[model samples]
Target: MSPLDDEAWEAWSPHELGQRLREATLPWYVAGGWALDIWHGKQTREHEDLEFVVIRNDADHFRAILHELEFFTVKDGTTEYLPPAANLPSDVWQLWGGDMRHGCWRVDMMMEPGTPDLWIYKRDRAIQMARSDAVRVSETGIPYLAPINVMLFKAKHCRKKDQIDFNFLRPRLSLEEKEQLTTWLNELHPGHEWIKKLPIS
Candidate 1:
């Protein structure tokens, strides 16, 4: 069994989790498969961990909070205090117990650049639950994302994994937003095969 029980998830639920970091209200965003679900409006598959994009300045605070949640220093000596057994990428911090393959106990956090101040004004925010009851663990308990922000992120990365996430999220977008994304993609990588090869379903 995983270290996180039902109650633990309650604490980590999107809204509750977000609230925990609200004091700092660090510039964080969702990324990876979970972010794809936010962009698509539905979960295409289970996630292994909760991937977050944070500003580098907030890294220590983020680590401290995870420790409070019982996440030990699995890789304290490595570059960036990684959990060695978790085998994550150099940039990711892997917290124990999440069934990462199916999107269970692992929480992966990373740092990324934020939108410029002028563009930040255009971001959107919404509340969602792991299930559909509008229920959350705390004030910030709901899962949230900036759809356009995630979309732009996928566009720039364009790796196989990124394409897969975009594929899962694409069908959930409005026709206009889809068009805009397509236009953006074209501009980002003119005639890139990703536009034609991704499975819509």
Candidate 2:
């Protein structure tokens, strides 16, 4: 059961959320479909919610700044309020945030494993990259996941929107990004339909 009751919450734009966390020192980056939109330099579709990813080690730091909002730890489709400085269980990596004052859902906070300088793919620790290479910042200073990395994550789901995202970004992928994505997809999801669809030659 979710700790927070269902309520209407206003979805915040990436810029608005970025401004709210402008003072944060810990690493956080826009993720999900929004990241793809950022890479495209335009909003291709409406987003139901905003997602931001923070290193697991910095979850507490992230909670500290967003203390005013209500947070719930999600596991196996159940949710419980996340108390101050609560240590998230090993299997759990998602947090849902809602505005208490307005009774509305706000953000989906995703936790990932990595050090301050590296990003280790949770599914396969062997897959890693320097944090600098894993993220990019918009001209306005909003940090977002690099496109190929976002596509890699989306490949796991391959929903309609995910396919749209891939179709939109495929032509824009650099040679290196295309090669890396193809290699990772082949290793992680052998025979994924996108493998044949990707424009990599």
Candidate 3:
């Protein structure tokens, strides 16, 4: 669960947030439910907040672009504002961006492991792909996670929203994408219900 103060936080659209980081040279892509909406080329459902991913190694570059917002480290259900010079724990990957005045979280940033050329799946580092293969850009310049990759992330939870996402994306996946998703699902979550639904090739 996110430790966000709903009333105090103001959400930004993916494009809006992307524009804020236009000067950044590091690779970043929108993740979570919003990514799915971006892939569909329209809003499919209401989103609680927006999320994007940056490589762990590029954290400093990411911070440089979003310097106006206060960054907080979220770990073990507790949230603490990160001092400008403080180092984030190795196990802590999620950072919440807050408004300077009200301290309300507006962006949820996920720090992933990889380089500019490779995208290493955090759950299983063995599962890897070229960074180019893992993300795609919208016509409007918003970059988002590939649908198959996003579905793989959602498979572990399978919450109501996850189910909705799965149902919506299942029919849209290409044969190759479905095969790739199924292979990873079987390797990472052997008995996941989603595997049964994936088309056999």
lDDT of 1 by residue, 98-166 (tens): 433343344555543333122221122221122212111223243445453465656666776666776
TM-score of each: 0.51, 0.93, 0.93
Ranking by lDDT: 2, 3, 1
Best by lDDT: 2
Tens-digit lDDT track for model 2 on 93-161? 998887877777788899999987998887788999999999999999999999989888899989998
Tens-place lDDT per residue, model 3, 1-201, is 234464566768998898898888889999999999999888888887788999997877777688888788878877877765677778889888887665566788899988989988898899899989999999988889999899889988888998999999888889999999999999999999999899866
- lDDT scores for all predictions? 0.47, 0.86, 0.85
Candidate 2 Cα outliers beyond 4 Å, as residue runs: 5-9
Per-residue lDDT, model 1, residue 159, is 71
TM-score of 2: 0.93
Which 10-residue span in candidate 1 carries the lowest summed lDDT?
A: 127-136
Q: What ranking of all candidate models by TM-score puts the best one first? A: 2, 3, 1
